[model samples]
Every structure is written in C-alpha cells, then in structure tokens.
Target: MRIVAAFLLLTVFAGLAIFLTFTSSWGSLLIPQAAANEAAVAVEEPTPMPDWEGKFVVETNQPVVLRTDPFVAAQAAGLLRKGEKVALKGCDVSGLWCQTEAGEWFVSYMVGTLPEGLPVLEGVKVQAAPTVAPLVPTADPAALMPTATPAAASVLLMLPTPTPAPTVLPQAIVADAANLRAGPGTSYAIVGSANFGESLSLAGRTDNGEWFQTDGGAWIAGFLLSDPPAGLPVVEPPAE
Candidate 1:
C-alpha cells in the first residue's frame, strides 16, 4: 500500500513540472513576437522618386557658358555649342536655367531653336549648316569685248574661263567694346564703335590678332563676355 501511494505522488509532481515548462515556453515566444510587431509599426518606409529622362534642343544658336551658380561670375563651368542637344535629367522651374547630368547649369537664352517634337533616349536631330555650291563660269560684261582676230574668237569660244570670286566667310561679333579704324591698330582713327557682341564681317586680321574688315561698315564692340542677347531667333540663310 505505501508503494502505490508514493507512485501516485510522483505522477502528480511530473504532471505539474510539464505544465510549468509549456507555460514558460509559450510566454517567451509571445513576448518576442509582440516586440517584433511593435518595431515593425514604429519604422516607416521611404517613398520612391520619379525617373524623368529626355533629350532637349537648344532654341537659340548662341554661345552659352555653363555656370556653377545661378548668377554669372560664380564659376567657369563650360561652354555649349549652338544647336546642340542636351540630355536633361531635371531642371529648375524658373525656366531661367537647366542642369545637366554633370551638374552644370546653362542659361535658356543661349539655345538654338529646338525641334517641334520631343524625342526620348534616341537620336535628337538638329539643323545643320547648308553647303555652298561650287562656283561656275560667269560672264563678265566688262571683260567680254567682241574679239576681232580668229585666235581671239577661239579664246572667246573657250567660253572666257570664268574666274572664281573670293569666298566670303562667316563674321564674328565683338563681344566687347572694340575700335574700328582705318587699319588694324589702336593708333588708327576710331571711325566707328562696336558694342558688345556686334556682328561684323571679317575682312582679315593682323598677325598680332587685330581684326580688319573688307567692307567699310561700322559695328559695335565691347569687353563683356555674355551669351547672345535674349529674344533674337536663330536666322536661317535662304536656301540656294
């Protein structure tokens, strides 16, 4: 009878021990899960940004310098060729400036006229300069007198080989105050004044870098380094 009573007591103690072990395990798991849920609620996720990429055409065919700051004289960044295409990542809403992928700012006024449609990631076509035609034989009435001799008639029959006219080159404007004189020298009388970025036909220049003119025309010159003035559209020469 004593042995039976001892076995019953041991069995009850074992049952109690198992119950306590299960309860402790359940509590530990619940606490960790609750803590994890709280941490998840406290942390917030960051929002994603938009991706905008496109090619833009320069509206004006003017020389534009890229700047580090919005205002001029901040820092010498770079120069943009006229009628060049730029890949725009983003821009300032003021419409006064645009930023390149390299983090350079360029003024809006210096752009050549952009194409009517916008293109993405592909080739952005731009206007190119026209090619001049080859010079042909032209009759000079002053030189063309009726030949009396057979040799002269034969020469005239050769169609009076036309002489090529001197080719005219594009002129550079004075970006600053420049003096127009009888010759390419400061000592030459200042017949006219050239203001900033004034367009003048280049006659020729002295070896010392002084510019001259073939035609006796006056222009404005200056010392200021600025992009072409705003509001002037790119002028396309008439087609041949």
Candidate 2:
C-alpha cells in the first residue's frame, strides 16, 4: 500500500512539471524564431491626419480610386464607392483635388459638391458648357442712362418711382413642377418646391447658365422654366 501511494504522488508532480515547462519562458526555445520575434515586437500606430475641413460624398457612378497624391498618376492607396460619405481636410483653390482624413486624395469632379441646380463653376474644371454667343452688343453702361436735368433730379429725389419697379427682381414661372433645392443641382438637398405656374424671384445664375438661383437662395434647373428674362445677374453657387 505505501509503494502504490508514492507512485500516485510521483505522477501528479510529473504532470505539473510538464505543464509549467510549456507555459513558462522555457517554451520559447521550442517556438519558431520568426514567430517568437514577431510576438516580442509591438505594432506601430499610424500617423494622425489634420482636423477635417468638411464632409462630401463620392459622386462618381463607379468606384473612385484614392490616390496617394493629388495627381491622377499618383499611386492608388484604396478605392471608394459611389455615394460614400467622406470627411475632407481641404481642396486646392483650382478645385482639382480634394484630400480626405484618411490621408488619401480623390479627384474634385468625382466627388459630390454643391447641388446640381446651381450654375457650373467658372474657373473650376467641370462639364464643358456649350459656347454661347453675345446676346447683345457691349456698350458703355454709363452712357446709356439719360442725363437728368436739375429740375428732374430734384423731383426724382423727392418722389422716387411711385412703384417698387426699382426693387422688383427678375421673375420666372415654374413651367414644370420642379423642386427647389438648397444648392444648384438635383444632388443637393431639397428645401422647398415650386408648383406649376408659380412665379419665382430670380437673384442670380450660374456661370454656365444651367441653373437659376432664387431670391431665397434656393436653386432650380434652367431647363425647368420658361424663358428667363434677359440680363439675369450671374452669381456663384453657395457652398454646401
């Protein structure tokens, strides 16, 4: 009986020794050198980007390649799908390239910007506007005004035009039921609506004249209206 009990005690000690040998520093000797070295190293963190300047959405129909640099020839870091929202750092004044918070760049035209109803950017490279001829011959604007006599000037100061004709802005009718968007394009958020035949007070137009900006700072497509009065003031689209 004493010899059997000693054998059981020896088995228990041997098992414990085997477990400790595998679980302790001694186990490293049996491990592959490369894996052991990798386990010893800490992962390096990525460098941080600057605070976001604004947010934008991917506007392209296909996946847009995120370039390492602003140029199209730059190495591609990754891809962004259409309509993917991204927070940007900033864009160049020329509006060619925009950088993201992830340290990647995308082409300016491939991203959603101001609404579609807004006029095309003047200097920015966008869809090429068809060439429009000069509607009227250029003349000295100052020479066109009639020279007022002293008596007429005095009367004008006393009683400005009895009507608000001077204050009245250019107006357009909603020939078709169209949406009034916050920006110039259909891609912009809809803020209001113009019923059929509703009259809209016009404030400005985009450079390409494809959109008309309302007095309330909303945008509607130029094609959505009847003939707009000539000499509508050309204005820039509001930043979204």
Candidate 3:
C-alpha cells in the first residue's frame, strides 16, 4: 500500500512541473510581443505639406545641375540662379528634393536662398505680371497740376511736386550660392537660403547694401546687382 501511495505522489509532481514549464515559456514569448506592439503604437506620423506651388532659391556656392528630365543621367539643359525663382511643383520626401513644375529637382539648401519679398502662389493661380514702365518726367510744370482743380486753385500748386522716386525693380542672377536676409547688414536675420549655380533677380536695394526681392514667395536679401562674386558663373536667360 505504501509503494502505491509513493507512485501516485511522484506522478502528480511530474505533471505540475510540466505545466509550470509551459506556462513560463508562453509568458516570456507573449511579453516581448506585447512590448513591441506598444512601441509601434507610440510612434508619430509625418506631417503633410501644402498643395500650392511656387519658386525657391539656391543658397550654396556649389554648382547644382538641373537636367531636362528629373533623372540624373538626363541631358543637362539649363542652370539655376541664386535667389532666382523657379516654379516648384511638389516635395519628394524619399529623395529629399523639391520637384519643380519644370521637372527640375533640387535639395533644401538650394531652396533657401531667398527670404523676404518672395512672391507666393498660395492656392490661387496667377499670371505673371507685365513689366512696369519707367516713370518719365514732363517739362511742363503747369501740366503737373490736377486737372479737376479751379484755375486759381491750380496756380497755388506752386509747391514743386517732389520728383517721383525711381521705381527700381529687383535684378535677377544666374549664379550658384546666393544669400538672402531681412536687411542689408550681415547681422540681419538670415531669412532665406540658396544653393550653388542658381540664377536670381535683383529687385532693389538699400544704401546699406541689403538686396530685396521675391525668393520662394517671400522677400529676402544677401546678393547685390552690382557684380557677380569672383569664381561664380553667370548664365543668361533664354531669349523670349
């Protein structure tokens, strides 16, 4: 009878050990899977960009090549300007480049060249503006008077009208690596950036040497219209 009792006790102990081993192994495997799933859920999503399109400037001195097509091996058709506005189509996140409407692709450094006064397209489509005519002065002083005024009142307009300030537009450049800023001084904020071998427009300037024009839909300053920096190449725009 005692042998029978010992055998039954040994059988019960063996069954308990097998159950514990299986339970521990299953728990270990499940815990890691649960932790992995939690980690995946904690990750954040990427932000989306606007659907509108416009231009960007080159902020570096390095020569950036733009091909007739987006592929690298495509024939080199044209060059870009520093602070020059090119039509942007969309952003390519995987490639880290902006694809221009003209099918040109450029990196971020090339797009930061202009900061302030850059024209923006927003969601609205706009036609390119007509060139502004130069303001010319007339010799007849009396002709400057308002026509709606009485003859006696017109004579009182003797106060010489201040000469209209010259309407200077920003000039464009076809070089690589231009600068853009809020003001003419280097201390001013670097509101824009650019890449190498880019062309740009010089709209106007201040006496302090600050340049102002549209860069990527905003106004920025850095380069001037006077002279191209030494070692930089300049390309003329195709004839209209």
Using TM-score as the measure, which candidate wins? 2
- Candidate 2 per-residue lDDT, tens place, 1-240, comes to 999999999999999998997788666765677676777675656789644343443345434567676543345587677666666666655565666767786666555653323222243333333344455644655565567798699765665443322557778877656678888765789899888789999987777666788989899876556566556667777777
Local distance difference test scores for all models:
0.50, 0.65, 0.48
Cα error, residue 19 of model 2, in Å, equals 99
Q: Which portions of model 1 miss their true places by more than 4 Å?
A: 1-54, 57-60, 113-240
Ranking of predictions according to TM-score: 2, 1, 3
Scanning candidate 2 in windows of ten residues, the lowest lDDT window is: 114-123
Top lDDT hit: 2
Model 3 regions lying over 4 Å from their true place: 44-47, 50-240
lDDT for model 2 comes to: 0.65
Q: TM-scores of the models, in the given order? A: 0.27, 0.34, 0.24
- What is the total number of backbone clashes in candidate 2? 7
lDDT of 1 by residue, 75-168 (tens): 6487665555565544454444556667676654446443344322223222122223444666675566665587577666777555657755
- Give candidate 3's whole-model lDDT: 0.48
Over 4 Å off, model 2: 1-165
